[model samples]
Target chain A: MNINLTPGPSQLFYTVPDHARHAFKEGITSISHRSKTFESYFQKATEGLKELLGIPTDYFIFFTGSATEVWEKSIQNLVENSSMHLVNGAFSNRYFEIAKQLGKHAQKMDAPLGQNFSSIPITNYGTELIAITQNETSTGVSLTNDFIREVREKNSEALIVVDAVSSMPYPALDYSQIDSVFFSVQKGFGMPAGLGVWAVNPRCIEKAESLLARGISIGSYHNLPTLLLNALKNQTTETPNVLGIYLLSCVVEDFLRIGIKKIRQETDYKAAILYQALRAHPLMSAFVKDESAQSKTVIVADCGEHSIRISNYLSEHGFNPGEGYGEKKKSQLRFANFPAHSKEQYERMVDLIENLR
Target chain B: MNINLTPGPSQLFYTVPDHARHAFKEGITSISHRSKTFESYFQKATEGLKELLGIPTDYFIFFTGSATEVWEKSIQNLVENSSMHLVNGAFSNRYFEIAKQLGKHAQKMDAPLGQNFSSIPITNYGTELIAITQNETSTGVSLTNDFIREVREKNSEALIVVDAVSSMPYPALDYSQIDSVFFSVQKGFGMPAGLGVWAVNPRCIEKAESLLARGISIGSYHNLPTLLLNALKNQTTETPNVLGIYLLSCVVEDFLRIGIKKIRQETDYKAAILYQALRAHPLMSAFVKDESAQSKTVIVADCGEHSIRISNYLSEHGFNPGEGYGEKKKSQLRFANFPAHSKEQYERMVDLIENLR
Candidate 1:
């Protein structure tokens, strides 16, 4: 009876296809990790993912345990020297912290928490990588493509690694300017979590291999060259999440059927409806200043009271909103509209929020 | 179709339960990850796992995306340099490699790759932590409790960490003497890959907290302390593989109903069947020298010819034996007998191998 508006294990308010269920029950449960059927399934999912994301042919897609694993991989594979990081929110700051912990030469361009990612600072040419959080799930602030391009322009030699965990497929991705992009299946993919989707361009792949050749042992599981070889065939070197990969295939088929542009439009309409409802509310204010920079996927707002009160108020009535992540613990709440959420569900949520106010 | 005999993601070869299908379809897809019902499912699964494993009250059970995550967490929180590691095979060797990769001080007690893990060399216990792999899946070896007790007696201050990845309920664990144990659901748990089961003793928790109290960041998402807090409520900090988690619950129920001893008996019989078949062939010899070290889960053998040829030969028919891992490339092939394999299936596999030979 509870409505999940929390981000990430966001919500699947719609019916999962019967074919996916059948595959999980009849096919995946007993299949060995070494079987060809699983190999094909794993490969197809990765290929489908690459196609859906508009990644180039040179880009290889890998499946890992979590997007958080990508953080370690990024630190291990990239960032040999000082790197510039755009830290506008929680996940971004986390990346900076991870880089520091790995003893990587790294620096952060800090934007205030819960604010739009404005101008990124210039870095020295020796910076081997430039990192950013594309969709700041904690604050609902998204860094536009233009901002990324500017950073790329400033640091041409440095590889660009983007944590696109929350804002993929919906707005569609333009990987032409990026080196590597990573996400988990939970958010925009409308599937359960556990698997990380990584698309690495040939340049990034070569860079990772070069790092490996330098005798830097980037933990066996996250080893990019090993991952690339398996990813080429759409398989993981270690045991993979078979059911999740199968379900993601179903989701990919649905995406191709509906088309990404149509899905984006539909999602836009849903976001508009929710935003209109929020604007009408006297007690709430959007956390991000500009609507353009705000994420269409998640709605972060100051409840004009502590987030716990508003979150509790919403939860008591069956709707659960996102809690403030990072430092904005008390005053902010978030609402996520994932791929599977319906117009009716959005309406129900708004009505519930209105009643709470 | 191809039969999966990879030990894990091992072959399911049977139909999944009906209630699980119903739950996935009509019951729990859209339920909030934080909802009471969803929490109940998660909470019940953890409790069920603890009961199913006969875990002590003092032990804490948690969930992670993969057993690999457990590997990183074990190092991040548990080991503090001076830890002794027993490396009997490829999988066991990787643990110390990961520890070294993470800048932890770990010493290895090396056993020949295909030999049984005899005992831990106690003299090198510079740290208060000791790790052992329970079942070396790569070499088809299992370590006995007597070996564990011998190690414990040598280093009483050291916490014992066991990677029970390939030897969970199927072999029946006696955690009464162990501090922490980890396994993946993909193996003997009879579920799809993705979800990992982590159980830690109270002493390990205290040690983790003490380490955390210092400036050591256990990396976000994989942090053991935060993971345990969520585990107490049967929840994870990030999105979990809901489908895999649910399937694991069904698997636990089935395992408990069947009884651990009966399951072990069944797996043993299947292993014996495969071994007898292998012994009859002139072109084949058991991979490991010690028959006692041969795992009930998988039977590793020398195909006498190239392993790839034998693997391809068996796979051309209905049989799918696992490939040689790491440096054991040309000589070995592994025959896996998970609990799900039927007796008829085993006989058919033996027949196919005999015919192929």
Candidate 2:
């Protein structure tokens, strides 16, 4: 069997196929979102999300199409004129661009590729909200808790948001430090793609309402206020990806059974093993040099032209990792260490990588 | 086996379980969307949609969250300032409200519940676009071809968009009379909800470009230009419901194999038997009066106080139809005749309905 290790949409959580069978046999996917049956599914999924992530009761969670969509909705509902972005790679930079595309005064602090905020005192420059990418999937870099805590301390008046897309369930985020945070399921949750989970506190709702009072059109249908109203009713404003939500509930339950602390510890262990193997490789090395900034979930290696040979060798062993993104597409490889990957798999993968010519 | 006669999310196409099983075994859900594997799935789905729907070469098909989303997107891309709508019931009226919410000059012509336009010279009120819910799922009302043709001929200069949400693959819409149209797969296509298919011709793209040139912010990401630009690459602006798209492609191929003409004919026959049985019922009759306006797929009946008793009987017999929408929630039941429900199942439903006390 080919062991999928790509960052997003990587490997099925082993339990998904069986859970999907249950969804099909029970007609879970075919039930109306407004029906009591569907409401229960929705409730289970959202509640699981809260318990697994330790989300506060005051924080409201909403589902969107993808995490990329959360970027658009955030700018629409939270910011009136200006927003700040800490851009370390393509995904973070795209969030900044989304703000600009929505006709906002978007300011960005740029960090070079494969690098993240390692120091304190990141400024938002009077913007109404600051977007921090906690995990940069594109370059396998991440902002440390020290830097994030510093940002929260300095920008108490501004709305703080984080993209925990590729590193969630492992992040154990302090909800008090951020008003809003979002992620997609395919990465950290080890499910199929399509559903984006967005958690926002009461402050975020208040900000959205204020925008509405000021005659700002948040959106046509998925206005944050509207999403909140439906979420309160235990459903979404539109017919959602019911199956995705249901499967996510199953995986989150598994995560709960396994516990988040164990998942986080395993992720760190796997990441360490991969990085150590990268150091021994002839043509590959850890891309993010700073230990504090290196991502524990998505580990990148600068392989130059040897990426192809390494990939071929891994493929022969029934292993695969995600290709490098953007400008480094041809010269780097990103290995995801999400919960779907076990310690045994990582050890085997490390052996193969170290054995590569 | 309970026959899922509910309009949407009612029943899987039966082939779905096997296809989903195949998807799971192949790790289809976990692959990167940008990979060649995913592109092939995207290309297959879009191309299959075109073949099945007879979508012209110039028309671009894009996948969105749901048909409810297409309502917002149509307003964003096809209209600059003003648009007109034909509102028959809740779903159609919601589209009109979406336009107003998006800060557009939205005008509407309202029809009472269970009514449709039998006569025409249906006007667009000099608006740039006319939004028509081709088959309004709310009350099982539909606009006839004659009325759609009149609107097209009367306002040749304006764009004409359609919402075929709950009644596509059955309505052989004249794409020549419309600039854009969309539908979700749950209803007529017999798939799970969450993906909306939008087809827009070159004129729609031009209108969007002109609006952009005029400095109007058409929101962010999933913009028409960006969607089309990425569609040419067989992908989307963000990570899409990759599995949803894959399943839809499989279902559409099945549709092609059985042929659209056969599906429509089967729908008509099934609707006829159900409506005929409704006439024999003591407490229910066809919700729609005009024959041409009665939906072929979503056959709604005015059930009054007896809806529960009838629903209970049907439930005992292993069958369930959809509840009424909006104000008619408890007073009506909607029987859906999608391709997934076999002829034998419909005949059995008729027997059950006719024998109801």
Candidate with maximal DockQ = 2
Q: List the residue pairs that clash in candidate 1.
A: A30-B11, A30-B12, A32-B9, A33-B9, A43-A234, A307-A330, B82-B126, B82-B127
What does candidate 2's lDDT look like per residue over B152-206, in tens digits?
Answer: 9989999999899988888888889999989998878888788999999999999
Worst 10 residues of 1 chain A by lDDT: A117-126
Over B1-357, each residue of candidate 1 has an lDDT whose tens digit, in order, gives 667777776765243545456665654554445557667778777778787778887788887777876777788788666567788788888788778766677788887777765533445375677888988888887787777777777777888899989877765566766799999877676666778888898888888878767766455566677777877776776666666666676667777787767778888888888888778877777777677777778778887565777788778876777777666656788777777776777888887777765
Q: What is the TM-score of chain A alone in each candidate?
A: 0.93, 0.98
TM-score of 1: 0.83
Report the error of model 2 at residue A352, Å.
1.0
List residue ranges in candidate 2 displaced over 4 A: A119-121, B119-121
Per-candidate interface DockQ score: 0.40, 0.84
